[model samples]
Every structure is written in structure tokens, then in C-alpha cells.
Target: MRLSLEQIIRYQTEGYLIVENVCSHAELQPVIEEIASEIDKRADRLFAEGKLAELYKDEPFERRYSLLHRQCPEIGRGFDIAGYLGDEIFKLLCNKNLIDLVECLLGSEISCNPIQHLRAKHPARGSADGSSAPDYFQNVPWHQDCAVTSEDSEASEIITFWMPLVDATAETGCMEVMPHVFKLGYLNHQAEGGTMIVPEKLPQVEPVLAECPKGSLVIMNKYTPHRGISNRSDIIRWSIDLRYHKTGANSGRSFQPSFPVRSSSDTGSVLRDPDVWRTLWREAANGAGRKIHRV
Candidate 1:
């Protein structure tokens, strides 16, 4: 989990680093199983409502959602699962390996940014020939994480970890990033299908596909310009995008609460109770509405 000097340097030089096997299957199983359970519940409900003919009970986690979406395209758009701030998810957020790698970059004091999401990118039937038929959510446009954040956090050094539950290949809409663009700082982004870097301002560098195996992580800075491609494969791409930054630093969006995950200086401040962590998100979810720049 602790990154080597070369890995740290690579992240600094290229704006991203793919850390293979940062976590083991044992460490990831709980989170994966929790997601699979949620999928099963949804599948049952859809089946009862006559939306899905078969539950695909024997299908694996990677294929279940895609199969469900294939049978009922109407269920695709609303399939994105939020409220993942459960106990299992919190355990993954505080994973020692992940935290150690993050500490190497952001120091010992770490705050878990609230702008995290578990993305289940279903298969797109459309051709990969630059077609517009792909669902907007399946194919994310080019954009920097910082661009989607509030303006006040422009200077914050937020480290993002993109970890896939299944093997993510180019065919499965693995992330692609423009090398060394983080050094250039935040770029102008506009809302297309999603918040994206302006077409004219996109980096000219050839994008590198971040193909990663299950339990691996693609770590990037807030300014890294990256996007997910359309999932042309048959299976759904299950990935979690989590963010962390130095404790007490701005979390981009002040409206959402960021909890201390690791704090050597103030050990008592570290969140140990999963219920408390879940409550933080529950309060935010129930609080007054604010316009958030969706990524």
C-alpha cells in the first residue's frame, strides 16, 4: 500500500499512477458483496413488477446489472446506486492499504471527501466508432475532477482513487487520462452529457487507457483530465471513485461533509463508528438543497 519512490514520481510526472493489486480480493469482498446484494434486491423488485422477465440469479456480479439493463432498458437510467455510505463501504474507505498509499501523497492527516460514487456502467449496444448513441452516463466526457468541484477548492490537493470491482479493460470503458495535464492546473469545463473540459481546451497529449485488474487502483490528482469510455462489452463495469485530501483542507464543495479518516496529529478525531460516518452523509442528503456541479 505504501507507494514506492518511483510510483510517487510517476504520479507526479504523469498526473496518475495505476497501482496494481493495492488491495486483495479478501479485502474487497465485503464491499463487492454488499453491492451485489443491492443489485439482487433491485432485480427482485423489477421482476415482480414485470419489468424483468428473469432474475438472472446465477449470473455473476459483473454481468447481472448489464443483463438487467439489457432486458429492461427503461431501468438503466435510474440504476445508479447512491447512499453507499454503509458500514461495508466505510470499511473500504478506511482500508489500511488505500490509506497508506494516500498518506504517502497527502500526509498522515486524511479526510474522506464526500463526493464519492459507486458507478455501475452497463453495456452499451452502440458501436465504438465515435457514435453518439451510447448512453450519456456510460460514456463520460473529458473533464478534470477539480473542474466539477466548487471554485473555493481550486487549490486543494485532492487525491482520487478509481478502483474497479471487476477487471476494467478498454472494452469495459476503462478510464483514460491526458498525461501530465495536472501540472497545467484546472481547465475550463462545460456541461455536455456530463461536466466536461471545453473542446478547444482539451489536452493534445494522447490519452492513456488505464486498464486495471480487480483490486487495483488508478490514483490521480484533482487536476488530472480523464474520462470513461463507452462500455462495449457484455458485462457491467463496477467501479468506485473515492477522494481524499489533507485534513482541514477545503473539500471543494462545502455543502457536503468530509470526515476525518486518518489523523495522526489528532487521533481522537478519526471516525471509528460507521454509523456516525453514515449519519454525516444522511444529514447531507436530507439537508437544504444546493446546486452541485454533477460530474
Candidate 2:
């Protein structure tokens, strides 16, 4: 998964790499099924209890939307992705084809969070004029994840993995990135959710739409200025974003990376050693047990 020589240069220069089809539909089928099944099970249980609608009766749309998973299957706030998505989710998150690319760009000794999150959009009524109504596109505007956290400058040594479960297109609202923006260094994002490029510091390049097919993985430095597209299409746009930090780099957790990355995948570790990676990969195949069918 180590990046190609060109990929490294491109990343250093453009601040992002759009690796197409990092995972195939076949590769992602199991996890997609698992996620959909989880959604159905939770929805069913809540409906049966006659408390689903009442749960958000008093909340605003924004808060209600954000808290949907909370009232169902815990989302974020001490979220352990490995426990939920199971090992394959972690493998997909740490797959060498992509991790190698990340290590090449960010260096070795990586520590990744096991929290895998899904963002989906469904059809709703009377949406904003230009906003994609109903379907929830994962795009959260152009802002760095670090900007929202209390972690200081040193936490910039991180990369993000955005894996889409469906084809990400312009119409469907894929990612839009300002190439080489990171080379200008991290820009200060305004408090009102707007980010601007440093004036004349970096040459301007037209934003590129990251139209990737289902299972494609995009890896980029955390400081890269990027944002999600609004899903104008009726179909749901689903994706999972996984973040990783270098072992010694500041992770915003008191300036120290949290949790040791098992150098091997045997115990669900995502270490950088090649031999360990192979061993763990094989273990994944044998231990996958039965494929979890999608709902």
C-alpha cells in the first residue's frame, strides 16, 4: 500500500492523493452488510419500543440529526471502531496499499483510531434551496478536523482515510480539495465555518472533485483544506472516514498519541512492519468466520 514515487511527489506538491478503487465492491460487501444490518436492527428495536419518534420530538433538526446514532448505536465520544465494524473494518482502515502511501507521506510509527464513522443522507421534506434535501451527504464543509479540537500545533502530523461505501460523484457530492493548499501551511479557519487560502502564498489551483467509485479510498494530510459535497441526488451517499496519527506525533490527546498500535494485526493491530502486516492479513482471511450478510 506504499505510495508510488509519483504519488509521494504529487502528495507533497498537491497535498492530497486520490487513489481510485482502493477497495472493490467485493472487498467492501461484508462491512456494508454489517453496517446496514446494524441500522435495521437498531431502527427495528426502537420502533418496537414505540420511542423512536418521541426521542427527538423536542430537538432542533441539526441536533436531532447529529444525535440520531447516539440514541441508537453510540457514535463518537470514546467510540471504538474495531469493536463495531469488526476486524475487516480495521483492516480496510489500515490496509497496506493505503497505509504504505500514508507512511510514505507522513513517516512511520503510526497510531490509528479504531473509530470508523458513517455519514448517510436520506430524502427529507422542504430542504434548503441549494442544499441537498433528504439524503445526508458526509461533506461537512471545508475545515480541518484539527481546527475543531483543543490539540495544539504539533498535532498536525496526521492523515485521514475517507472510504466511500458508494460511488462518490460531483452530483452525489464527493470531496473537493484545494491542491497544494497544505504546502502553504495550515491556514486559519474562520470561526463561522469558512476557510480561505493564504493570500498569494500558494498558487491557486481549481478545486478538484474527488469522484471515486464505491470502495475507493482517498488519503490526505490532515491539514489539507478539503470539504464534502452536498448530495443532490436522491440516492443516499454513504462513506466512512478513518483517521490515523503517527506514534510519536501529537494526537491532540495532551500532545501524545493515545493507545499503542499493535505492530502486528494478530490482535487487531495496525503496525507498520511488512512481515507483521502479511501475517495479520492472512489471519484476517482465516478468521473472518462467515461473511456478515447485508440487510
For all predicted structures, in order, the TM-scores are 0.91, 0.67
State the weakest 10-residue window (summed lDDT) of model 2: 286-295
- Candidate 1 Cα outliers beyond 4 Å, as residue runs: 72-84, 126-134, 285-288
- The lDDT leader among the candidates is 1
lDDT of 1 at 113: 87
Write the residue-wise lDDT of candidate 1 on 1-295 in tens digits: 5899999999999999999998899988988888788777777887889999988788888777666766776655434323545578888888889999999999999999877888887777663422223476477888888875778887789989999988999988899988898888878878865798889998789999999999999999888999898788767788998999898888887877788989889999999898887677667752246656643
Global fold similarity of model 1 (TM-score): 0.91
TM-score of 2: 0.67
Residue 14 lDDT (model 2): 78
Expressed as tens digits, the lDDT of each residue in 181-279 for candidate 2 is: 676555555543244333343345687887877877777776677777666554556778877776655555332224334343344444545344435
Candidate 1 vs. truth: CA RMSD? 3.0
Best by TM-score: 1
Number of clashes recorded per candidate: 0, 14
